[model samples]
Target: MKTSISKAVAPVAFVLALAFTLLLHGAVPFWGTPTLGQAVWTTGFSHSFVNHGLLPYAYDFGAPAPASIAFGLAGAYPAALLIALGMHPADAYAAMVALWLTVAFVSAWWLGIRAGAGSVKSTLAALAWVTMPVIWAHSGYSMLSTGIALLPFYSLAACMLFLDDVQGSRKIGRALLYLSSCLISVFMDGYSFMMFAMGSSIVAAYSFVMNHSTRRRLLTYSLPVHIAGFSLAYVLFALYIGKPSFGAAPLDFFRGWGADVTFFLFPTQGIHWMWDTLGLSVPRSHRELFGDSSVWKTTYLAPLLIAGLLGWLFTFSKSRIASAALIIAVAGLYLSLGPSLKFNSLVPQEIIETGVNMQHMPAELAIAPTGSALLSEHLPGFKNMRASYRWVALAAFGLWFLLLLWLSKAETLGARSAAAILCLAVIGSNLPHPQRYLEIPASNRAQFKAIDTMLVDDMREALQPGEQIAFLPYRNDFLVNYLAPSVPIRTYNIGGDKNLAMARENWPKTMRQFKMNKVDPAFADRLLWLLAQGEADAVVLPYIDMLWAAHAWPGGKIHQKQVQPAIDRLSATGLVDIDTREYYAVVRLNATARVLGQTALQAKLRQTLCLPGFCVRQAASSNAIHSRVGRLSANTLKSDGRRGFLVFGPYEPVESGTYLLVVWGRAPVPAGAWVDIVSSRGSTVHAKFSVPRTASRPDNILLEEKVVFDEAVDDLEVRIFAEEGSRIAITGYELRLARSGPDKD
Candidate 1:
């Protein structure tokens, strides 16, 4: 009776302690949500679910699919529930993390009991699992961190599937647990899914080899279930992505994001504040740590766990569990080292430099690639995964299992005392500094909330429900996406999903034309003409987006100088009415726009051949020249001494097929410059012609070229390559369709 009472009381005590620790860390159900990093991204998804239900648009102006499923489907239901209960999206996200963390802790403890640990040892192992530096460091990343938290649960489910000696209802329950865990694991994140798959496969193979009795059970129950569960999960994931392909992380990402061996021993970065406060700063002062980023340096293991792991490896233990643990731990660590070996961020230099023996030198940073490279290139699942450091999660779990084994062997009072100390050491070593908590100030949170409310109200006032809208500088999406949850308006500005990133790629190309001192009349007309055609009911220019784009674009200083002029030009087109606010402007189609159909709009946009000289960018220099000839004045950009690209750009999106480009510009004689129609960045040249030498006093040389675009292109530019020290002046140019038909691409 006393023992049962103690077990009951112990869990309550653990719960209280866990809550306090999470509170101190500013985790959710305790405080405000984080305002930085991936937290905002996670919050956006929760908000979408709360407002739009399950099949909300992912991004790129309502490209349909719940893109969040690819990142955090495991946490989506909980997040949605919290948000529905009036929690802020950020807080809801935090609550989801806290919930998973609690589940992880409970699962670890349960696994310990199943592994024959006493109550005290079980609690310690569970404590150690949740408080690992890797776990805490990744908490802000939503389901990625939750996936780490769920690893123990997955392990527990796998153990039961292979080793449990149950019958009838109990056996069915175990199978259900295994299936549920597998589904949740795969839904959580790819890293967690792959780790679970790898770890479980190892266990299954071992059981098959050693336990002949369990082989039929595994083949009959586990194999079929694995097939069914993984197949269903894949179909669900494909539906969530809305396509067969997922966002492909770049190849170099694998090399850059790989783990450093020393980071496993070194304290992670976020704990320095505690050391500084205690005057124990030396441990945190190392400036030469090798890793891609501070965030990736989160594989720190407790010193006690490391000693235990080493002891288990060296000892002559025939325990099958211990052997499996060692094998898994080594495999995980080796794979996490990625395709190279790194030590303290230092690489060996050539021995020839100091007349030192080559044998005395440290190994070079990277080898000429290895088996991991081949796996990443050719392996099915690995090809999609780039962050090899995440494999350390499996390593950490294996180490935790070894620690539990060690704990189970300790039977005396002194051993229990040592186990308690181990738990304390794990918690102390991994405790993140208070400043690491990404808590938003109450005032800032309230301010943002108010801004969102006002923006929603403003959008509603400007447009009717279901009206499609487009935001200017189209990539400014976080606030726009947040607004999506509250406003009834639909838009093309979706959250940052890579597949849809190119949905409106042509908008920037058109907007880039305005970077010059003055907007072209033809360009301004085209902008208005597109709007009048009703692709969207309105265009919103948020003050926040305008400010961001002013500094975020290339040649931003030039963009800043040209913004007002471009706005004025766009407004003067008179096709749409602008409703200006202090924080935003709404451009709505007027009565005149409603009457202008496709044919009239096309005729309006087809004002060809009047493009001015200032429209052509002087790639060599930014300075412009003003000249008057009789009654006519020209704004021309002169070339500097630099040899390449004296004139280029007005990079406008154009449909495929042949087009005529006419340039009225003058240059030094004897082929001083050559003009061509080329790809946006001038990589592919479509047509080229030499500039005609002009003996006239006034700078007027007519050069025309016919360029054929085999496919529709987003950024097509007319370029001029100049000889060194060649003087050139571009007066004007004209681009027109070589074939007469309505645009249909």
Candidate 2:
């Protein structure tokens, strides 16, 4: 009667868990920002491949083909198909999530059964694995890391093949199952593949030590399967990325991302609230570290789960599987600690002086280098293992296996009842609060509509075939989401340092000229030349101010100030503003380089009247100068009673010629002033004049200066210096440029 009741529990628990997971994720489709952004990119890529037959590896960004090859297309391809069938991208992505969750649950249940647990125990084990906070937390942020969902099934297949429990046709079937799982895992994500490799190696080593016959079977059956799976994956990788290489990352990467010992002792904030209410004070610094190492927090087994495992260990200390699991768990925990060991509240004297004191102090504490760091320094490939906390996936599999093995040995009803209660406790402990899902804002239907029409539709209509476009103040997320499917139009951004380096490498001459000449003025000219020269068809300057304001972060204010000035200058050039909206403006080359240059020059001349403090009033549509000290104007331009200089025009010259600058002013008393005509490409021209003191107030004094540029100078800076206590008023100023070349307007 007890056996019958227990047999029904596994299937019922599996059903309930699956239903709950679907409900939680299905309702809120969007979770993490970065993950959603990447999903949008991936879906766009897949759609482009299916519709236009473009190469999957080809990217608008600077990656040498197949940069995403390692990311794999398991989730992307299916989502793409859904999109092709007219489903929304968000809905398609949610569907993929549901599918993965289902697979994870079933696989976990199978693994539990394989470990010889009763129905109720197996159900609990599966539920425990599926609902682990680390898994859900990863799913929320990095969808790619969710591939760890398949590790349980992979473990089951490995056990069946390596342990040689099955014979004849069953053994061959298990080998094939193991091979397929390996291939599927590789297609899921690179991290998942790494986890599989580590877990399988441990199993293989254990099998070799335990049975000589098993070792021979592994060589004959498992080795070939493993080799075939890896070879195929390698071939696919090599096709896109050219050659595969390791050690691209530094040793510091491995050390920095390693798990800390404190992570296991305290749960993340999502689970920490319960402990907090119980008066357990978690250090702020420790909490911060927990937040940083969210993925590493996978090592945190619930107290109930830990207790069950401990009980199992005590009861079956002599069991081979139990012993092996203990060894694997210890090894995984050690490696996860990374290359260095530092307990909470332990710090050097120098660090302590900087005010970075440790929180939640314990009496005994020490710090030292770890075995992982030593191995990583000496080992060739170990240095490439960045996130050491990821090793907890292996530890999780071993711990759960041991728990189930112990449960299988308890035949009495009391033990079964105890196991059932413990399993519920495990579920209760690991379950996330409702607030966790709501922490990240979901994308509304209206936002998606705006993205489709404002960005996607506009780009499709504006760009001609084979024409490329560049985004001013480039954002990678925009390029990936909007332009990935538009194969006819290539996109570029000066967003990341890597992209900037690639741009410099690809256009050495253009970059060198920009660097050498006037940086700001020449920047606009270079972009126009690049466009007119057919390097790009259009430049899209989005309403960066609004975007930054909406998603405010550090440096947002700086970026906002830069956007308007850049757009204003770019618009001044003779490029046609084809599409103008509050959100964005698209500019395309519509005139000859000389005409565009002249237009830009004319715009600069018009701005001369708009100089702040110097031009005080508008009388008869001309600026009337007023000079005063310590009085604030409505425009907020005030003069202090001291020597000061004012600069105007870092302007690009239209043509090579002589120019006359005339300043007409009157002074109540004699004062000294200097006028400077500075060329970015040539020598500075200086002129000094004195305002003559008069018994009667002077009407006006005329000062004229002549300057010449041998060539069309890229930039010019005009400056005026006022002497201390100089009471001078400038009524009018004029600049006249002579046309020297036939191309001059």
RMSD of 2: 10.7
lDDT for model 1 comes to: 0.61
Estimated TM-score per prediction?
0.77, 0.68
| For model 2, the run of ten residues with the poorest summed lDDT | 612-621
Collision count for each candidate, in order: 7, 0
Clashing pairs in 1: 59-494, 60-492, 60-494, 61-491, 61-492, 61-493, 61-494
Q: lDDT values of the candidates?
A: 0.61, 0.54
Worst 10 residues of 1 by lDDT: 624-633
Candidate 1 lDDT by residue in tens digits, 408-504: 6655787656656765666666666665554332322344455456555776677677776766544535555556555666665554444235434
Taking all chains together, the TM-score of candidate 1 against the true structure is 0.77
Clash pairs of candidate 2?
A: none
Q: How many backbone clashes can be found in candidate 1?
A: 7
Per TM-score, the best of the predicted structures is 1
Error of 2 at 84 (Å): 2.4
